[model samples]
Target: MPLDAESDAIGTLLLERGALSAEQLVAAEDLAEGWNVSLVQVLLARRWITLQDLYEQIAIYHDLPLVDLEADPADDTLVRRYDPAVMNRFSTLPLHESDGTITVATSRPGPRTLLHIRDLYGPRSRIVVATHLQISAALQKAFRDRHSHDAVFALAEQDPDMSAQQVVTPPQILVLYVLLSVLLAGVAFAPVPTLIALNIFLTVFYTGNFLFKGLLVWIGGAAQETSSRAIAAGAALLREEDLPVYTVLVPMFREPEVLPILAQALRNLNYPLAKLDIKIVLEEGDHDTIEAAERLDLEGVFEIVRVPPSHPQTKPKACNFALRYAQGDFLVIYDAEDKPEPDQLRKVVAAFQQSSPDTACIQCRLNYYNARENWLTRMFTLDYSLWFDLMLPGLERMGVPIPLGGTSNHFRIDVLRDLNAWDPFNVTEDADLGIRLTQKGYRVGVIDSTTYEEANVSIPNWIRQRSRWIKGYMQTFLVHSRRPVHLWRSVGAAGVFGFVFFIGGTILSGLLNPVFWAIFGLWMIFGAAAIEPFFPLPVLYLSLVNLLAGNGLLIYLTMVAPFRRRWTDLAPWGVTVVGYWVLMTVAAYKALWQLISNPFYWEKTQHGLSKHTASELAEAKAGGPEALAAAPMPETGP
Candidate 1:
């Protein structure tokens, strides 16, 4: 194959590299001839088979002795007891076994004699339990080695890159539904006279939402009086230097489109590059991402940690895998689509600097970056503006264990490790962890920081993404509420109220949005047939006033937030906030249904596919990775 003379060099290299022996390599080459591709390609094409594997008895065929790995004598703790009985639980993946020497298969060995096993066997071991994920990873590797996209590797792990804004309770949908439902139900019981009376429902719903928000804010403020005053006065309730180095773990799967954009945005973060630990985590089989990451000169700080293949393909497992190598003092997870305010790190630093040692976490705000993208983006932005700017603060004020948003949550590294990092089995591991933190008597503070991310603009993509979120909320609710009264004692009354309004309110809104939408449509179509939906001075004025007030709040918050971050451009979406909520209603409904049906499935959002002009692409190509940062969507507000 190597013109006879060079064949020995190739074999020697493989053997020296411990990839394979000369005879075994020759036999592999012969077996690989059936692949119609290169030897490595063939090795990849063959699923569940390790590169080091002597498949089809290549060793025996070459008259070589079986490799007995156990005899190597690397006695750590577990290896000290590497008899064979412990491995009996999992597959006895024969590494190499003899009377004196018995090699085993777990790659991940730990100090403990038994738990947290990394796979000892190579990636392509011959004797593997044929899990579907293993099959998928193998297929992906083979595809990458052959016919992958020009941007496939780069875009494979593309994400919107940020978390959603803080959450709100008794959403517009729930109030609207209660309003129309009460009035309409009353009207149904009566005659034409009751039709006009149905209007009371709308008033009640509006008043209820406002009243609920006001009351909760009041209660939270009262409870957090001391802390609020301290924060407001900028007194020594915290210190900045005390905060540890923070690592934000971002996991991506098949989101190659905006990979460059996300990396660039992160590079532009306020945190010092040396102090910041960013893990651009990828699934072990995601070679496209790994390859795409190769050319970019990440100066050691931003390392690519490949998630060893695991399934139900989870966010937590990726974090868990990357956590092992994290040298940070604290940890956070950011979505790929997030564009956090530049000074966000500064705020967190300040907050953590002054807080008590047990204050191990600081939750921040998540706001949409593209609130003005369309009608949908606008409503979505408004919803978020109210949540992060209003609800989460209120919740924090009340001292509740917030059902943590999926991203932008900071954690002390030691605290996280004490809790074993993220639970790989928990889908909404963030929420679960938050609850656990409270239960453990660790305090979580709030940082007035906003991580801007793209709202789901497309309907299908929006539904997929939103559904996973809703399902995760459901998971969080279930896991934490399992011990309800115990939780109440841990978080207190104000916290309980906050959880009901914020977390429970989310599930409620998703369930009730369609009902209200249906009623509003019916009133316009039938009940108010003689009356115009958008007419009459008083009605129009009231509607205008409501819309104006909502939009005004959004504009004010965005401007204030960005001003604090020194990025005034993001504040402009406030004007169009009214229009954005319409889109969220649609997403809410889809999320509700999917939560009941397919909870764990990730709704993949496609990025970079948005049409960029030839010149834009040219500019992008010219700047290489840096110029390609972030989507060109308007950051200006409503």
Candidate 2:
């Protein structure tokens, strides 16, 4: 509980090893701005320590307990010979006991911890060590290996893993109950009048979701223009060339098919090749991907970091592993399916270069390139169009922290690393990082650059991925709300409102929008519902207006997306966007259920690299006759 008791275990060991004086240790502690990063980071920044020296210190520091073991006369000589490797092989830590079971801490603990413990301890030794940092991890791995498997199963609820489940409704119990009460309360005014009030409520809500989206776009100004402006500002804010060298780490798992496409896309970034520190992070077990990279020998700009075999099984862990070696001015992440534009790096640089010191991240546009591939893709594309092109800009215009999507997000390298990079435990690390940055007095803004990606059209595939996204959003909401008063004070009322609009509103709308749609469908079928719908004639008329405005936006998106790509002929698919809403309603429900059942599960999306309509993509890429002339597929019946 006390900081110092556990704080400088290594620092004291260094003093004992003659690697650093107590005075030097104190100085290093004083310089470590939040008392988090290792002393080596401070010493390295000051050119006082070398990388080799740092690792050597850690190795010796770990050997301190062994030294202590040797000094104790009462200790058995066998204890002095106790192998650290035995514990490492078992993935155990040696935590001091306070209660039922103690934790064990060891560096580089492999996955098969139980087998090693059984081998060394002869299934008798109960004492174990775990990673010094993660106590929970060690306890589970060790206890599960040697102790009661049934007990672990009984404790499942304590840390039950959840994957995003099938989509369902949002948290509308309270809101709906209140609305229903109001409906009943208004019944005294007569059925027609009560119907009027109910109609007013639904109409206002339906209109609100639409307006909230439009408001984001209006406030942010044109997304494209804002992006272009950000190019200059971001670069200037980053101090342009004066910006520190930065690394961009992209972690891949089971993605050899999309790897080359991703590589080609990142290669197009405007950042100087020499200055661009791009690390293609890969899992240790993924030999096929490692082989593929080696075979490609994909230029010096791309470096592959095979994660240490012993790592938290998460994307963030892969990133953190690569981050240990990253050397750059800033860092950003892009998923495998992303196709960022050639000018995106410049845009991000401009935003940082020109923005205030408080700014920590700049989230660029993310839209699907193959949006017209299927009905699902079209619906997904529209959702993103409304989110990035519309909602994000509004948040930026309001000067709030926008919850960043998973990829094409840029951040100040030092600032990001200082915040512990990403949480390996958090599945939606990007969203969590956004909230954390905002909590820490940092700003998140929208940049103009657009990163195109593949949309999940397969029903199951889309469900899995969408569920994860919603679940992550739920985590973000919970994580931030855990400190509501603190969050409000830091981000202010407007920022908090923006947060609600983006996070709470998204989930709520997912449910509410469907109800509203259901009512409309009923009215369409019955010519008037059996239950007298509470709606004013004016509001009813406005609903039609809302419907038209909503439908019209489809045309806007198809036309708008082609502003640069100039696929004017394909703009006709905008009409299909109307039918696409039904798909979204279904997806939103699945996403909601997933939020409840599997909040942290990342339903993997399988990509179809085989859908490489090279001629079409080339045409889309050029935005010219060669590209445009290739033509889009004729409208298909789904």
Candidate No. with top lDDT: 2
Misplaced by over 4 Å in model 2 are 1-203, 223-243, 298-301, 308-313, 368-386, 423-427, 457-459, 533-565, 613-638
**TM-scores of all models?**
0.58, 0.61
| Candidate 1 lDDT by residue in tens digits, 1-638 | 22232233334455665666566666546644432223432333322244344222333233334333323322234332333223422323343334534444332122331232334433333332222122223222323322122111111132111111112123434665897887777667764445434334443444344445665544543444465445534523323323346677888876655566667667676554435667788887888877776555444346676665544467776776566556567787888766676666666666676698888788887877555566556556555655555556666666777667788998888887666555444457687677678777888777666787777667677666666666667665655555568779878877666566566666655565455456556667786554443334455344345344633543555444434334455466555643444555566676666555655555666544322323334655678645655445335422
**lDDT of every predicted structure (CA atoms):** 0.54, 0.59
What clash count goes with each model? 53, 55
Per-residue lDDT for 449-530 in model 2, tens only? 7777777767777766766666567666655665567889988998787777678766666556666677778778887544
What local lDDT score does residue 352 receive in model 1, on the 0 to 100 scale? Answer: 72
* Cα-lDDT of candidate 2: 0.59
C-alpha lDDT of residue 163 in model 1 = 16
